[model samples]
Target: MSAINFTDVVFQTPRRVCHSIWDGLPGAITQTRAMRRLGRYIYRRFTRHTVRTQSHYTQFMRNPPLLDVLARLLSEYQIGSTVKLASIGCSTGAELYSALYVLRRARPDLKILATGVDISSEVIKAAERGIYCPGQSAATNGLYLEGRPELFWEDAKALRDLFEVQHGGTLRVQDRLRKDTNWLTADATEGGLADTLGPQNIVLANNVMGPMDDSLAEVCLRNVMNLVEPGGYLVVDGIDLDLKTRVLATSDFKPVLLGQEELWSADGSKDGWPWVRWGREPLDRTEPTWELRYSIIFQHARV
Candidate 1:
């Protein structure tokens, strides 16, 4: 019994097991047609554990409200030269690219340095390539596995100036836009942000830790925080309210509300375009906090 392989019973389909046996059996054993039929059975069991997330496009939300806040900050501070920005969990580089586009549009004279980091290598590569197509390249890496196809079309339209669709149905980002974008692979749960990516003026740690347990999320949140420079901006839009409250209880940086303290945002720029914001002000880190107040104006807080 110890010699028997149980992969067939546990997960692999019957056809997969049969093919394995057929190849392993001695050449003297005749391969029967019945064996082939049995090998073709196509059912397999799935693991109960949740699968890892795939990288996805930002649904062409190239105009995130976060950009508006950052712009206001930059202008207020009179930032003349280079501005460093990092997108934590930058799935497929959409968010990072969007930031770059905004900076270039708002402050063309300033040089924009952007880095994108994600846990999934597949998604990182996709982000690096900076290419997409509704029919072919959109789902190339299995991202947006459950989202509808029409959404890609809508996103493409929203970001038309940034990318061009080829005759063969592949979308390519403009070379000018792709020049300054850098891609990195790292996990926030592990504290390598310092070595992998040095401190940044602004860090976007969005959409990763919110779903996890508080203890685990805290560890990951610290990892993300490590990437932010002193007095710098860190966007924690993905964390749950409870986790945010607990984690910020000890930190010196204030909590900035993005999109009225909601998971998703809308700035009313377009019918479907989503927007983001950053609001933060604490009476005292050691003292209690106050109620949620939405504000569009972001004062220049240069780190």
Candidate 2:
């Protein structure tokens, strides 16, 4: 296998498209060129589309047991009162909603403060809509459905007729958001996250550490640990478990693996968009590469 070369495309395609689209209809080709360059830089220089595409693709992917993995992780955490779970860089709210679904099923009584953080206004708005593309229901596996879609669909019609407007279809879920769950928009750096979440019972930094600055990662973990009360747990994705080991060693925590077997079939890791990661590396498969191939659950040791 060889590395896929995106460099040529990165350098040439954007200009070609820029010339093709904004060549005539522009007051400022200079500004359009700059914007197009920035767009190309984002899309080509990194795995920008991977997360967006994965949110939809997971419905079709057979290998990744997302709900099961989450259930295992939550069960391992054994969350209690004042439980807080943050999914850093949670784009489009799939992973956070997925966790919410599992938590609602496994421990409905637990007071959950689920916060989803993202930088994109468009994606956040999509999340607020909460009406997944009919396929997201697969990720839920019908775990915590309060009523049939028919019932909700009827309510949507009634609301439309009574109010003479369309407002409360899926967006109603955002309104019905538990007092504990919040959607925040902020940059992960600049101390925004440090202020929002504190010593959480379970903090999910899954797939976030790998893409962020090391200092940001440290601050993020430190914030979670600082907020975490004694006996509280911090859950991180195993993809960066090795790096986390180095970082955690300096802090006051120990590694506890939430087994990968139940979460992943023995043959190989299942495929899906890593709700918060770049793309999976080609050489990622090997013995117990749950974090690389699937999601891994880890608990924070004391302090």
Candidate 3:
């Protein structure tokens, strides 16, 4: 055998030890209030200097409760025959398509105009094609199906309505879902984005801000908020809660409490806990201002 690689072994040992400690902890202990507080403390200490990677991961119906609440809000509050929606940083069009499905299913009579925007030309092309192949990496095919595999199962007839199963197990977005939908390559952080897209009735900027630097994320959040029409809604998540709270406090937006908890616990936003830079903290209701801090959807005050 070659000489013992002590340097590599030493580095690997710490990871193994950390994993062992994590795995050894019981759910009872790990899920306790004290443990959660400790976890948050550790996360804050380490992630203060961390820089997050640009993620293109996405899935269909990643947050059903959010979409349901959005549809309900539109049906109740919006007084128009035409509804416009824009999904900024819309990775591979999965979330956008899911939103369209929910809105159309809820109110088929209304004319819906939807746009999916992403900075990557590659993802924009994939969104336009609307094709997802099985067993491919998200970077390769622009789909992350592992977390929500049941959505594609043959037995999941209701969820299956969203896609047309093609030859060799590929899924093509159905015509109904594709109709009146446009995909554009655009930088959401750039100025004049609001002018370019016009005011949208519902602007979704979810699962995209967490990886950005805090100051940049704040700027992007404000820019994205400007895309919303005066009375329209902005559905955002996956950012620093403190930053969000501060920004919303200064803005004319009010948090919508409907389905707030459900959206917080949704798949993409829920997992990894305090370890990953993009991971969300546990929803702590004991905090006095939990509702405003935890809510993922907010409606702008109508001028």
Best by TM-score: 3
Q: Order the numbered candidates by lDDT, best leading.
A: 3, 1, 2
> Where in model 1 is the C-alpha error above 4 Å?
1-57, 77-79, 135-151, 257-303
Which 10 successive residues of model 2 have the least lDDT summed?
A: 142-151
Clashes of each: 5, 6, 0
Cα deviation in Å at residue 302, candidate 2? 2.9
- Model with the higher TM-score, candidate 2 or 3: 3
Q: After superposition, how far is residue 216 of candidate 3 from its true place, in Å?
A: 1.4
CA shift of 116, model 2, Å:
1.4
User: Model 3, 89: alpha-carbon shift in Å?
Assistant: 0.4
Report every candidate's CA lDDT. Answer: 0.56, 0.47, 0.78
TM-scores for the candidates: 0.65, 0.52, 0.84
RMSD (CA, Å), each prediction: 16.5, 13.1, 6.3
Better of 1 and 2 by TM-score: 1
Off by over 4 Å in 2: 1-80, 134-179, 213-227, 238-242, 262-295
